[model samples]
Target: MESPGRYRYRPANTLYAASHDWFSPYLSRPVRELLDAGPHARSLLRSPRNVDVCILFTDIRGFTDLSRTIGSDRLFRTVDACIGRQIRIIEHYDGYVDNFTGDGLMAVFEGPDMTDSACRCALEVVSRALPAVRYGEAALAPIGAGLHRGDVAMGTLGCESRLTHTAIGDTVNRAARLTGFARGRDVVISERIRRGLSAETAARFAPVQADRRRTDIDAIAPIYRSRCG
Candidate 1:
């Protein structure tokens, strides 16, 4: 059996003055307050609203091969650790995690500075998490992130008993596809993301090489790549 500390996950932020809520790590403060704001907010939750948000997708590089070598149990623990750390970073930028996709996770950011905050968070994840999670040569993989900013249909979906609140649309789909091109501490961005950034923030990224560009994403806008540098 694993030790009590082995799987014990504590979030960086406390939900209240005395006790920490287990769901705190999963929902951002705005989202929680919106839900708790009473009956007047029901329509916002029940109806699909079109909103602009920055979508970020992050994956562990070479995770499949690492899992093959380290086995599933260890990989599970590693993923848990990495994601726990990232959730703090995401929340710091006012973003909420959408879901975890095996070795990766999808996060969403909104509000005025969403694009810039998402970019900074992605950079920090690659730079900060790599050194923290590293163990020997094959223990952990570097993080890669892809970001896109656009309109998405945000709403709840499912039966009354089981429902999921999420953002869906081409913007979210493009973000996931852009992540496929990221590798080893790299942050990839769609053209829309780059355009949304402040000039100073945009300076950190460069257009992806022609050979690296995907026709589909380019049809929307070109892609850019940035390292922690």
Candidate 2:
């Protein structure tokens, strides 16, 4: 937890427009009139759009094969449980559950010293799912996670019936790619997010044994996070 004295913040007074779009205008109001001068705000407000330093994706491995074997009714139920456990873990770490896409989730953590926290969140998310899963015997196989810390365009992606307010950039793509690279329950964090990690946390991750032959077995992108040192 950060000290309360570290941050100062105020919410831009928001008003819903006649057109259904919303707007907030900064006026002559004193800085003391702020919304959530919480400790997290100091770091969250650093980048106007992207206080987000991490984007993690955790998907049940072999979902496709399972779907074919189990049939739709049982499969969707299984996927829901798998994703639900991950969402709960992400929220516990002060991370936002951006969206749940089928069996996976995109989580965004906004707070101070986020790089270290994000790494911990990813580990926790994968750890929690193992115990939460139950019959019809759904288990998390090869939990994959991608992490990146940087500025990303953030906003409501749509309106009315459908919407997603999320982080968008190559950083996000790269993280997802890292997840895709993971094998046998690998965490698969990227170079960028790895660099952001505290020295102690960085020590936890091991290097990907170089695949010089370019084999099909470990193909996705480059880089992967296998274990904690």
Q: Return the top candidate by lDDT.
A: 1
lDDT of 2 by residue, 13-118 (tens): 3412222323212210111122233453334433336445577877777877767777677777777777767766776776666666677877776667677788
lDDT of 2: 0.61
Residue 106 error for model 2, in Å?
0.7
Prediction RMSDs, each to the true structure: 8.2, 8.3
Would you estimate the TM-scores of all the predictions?
0.81, 0.69
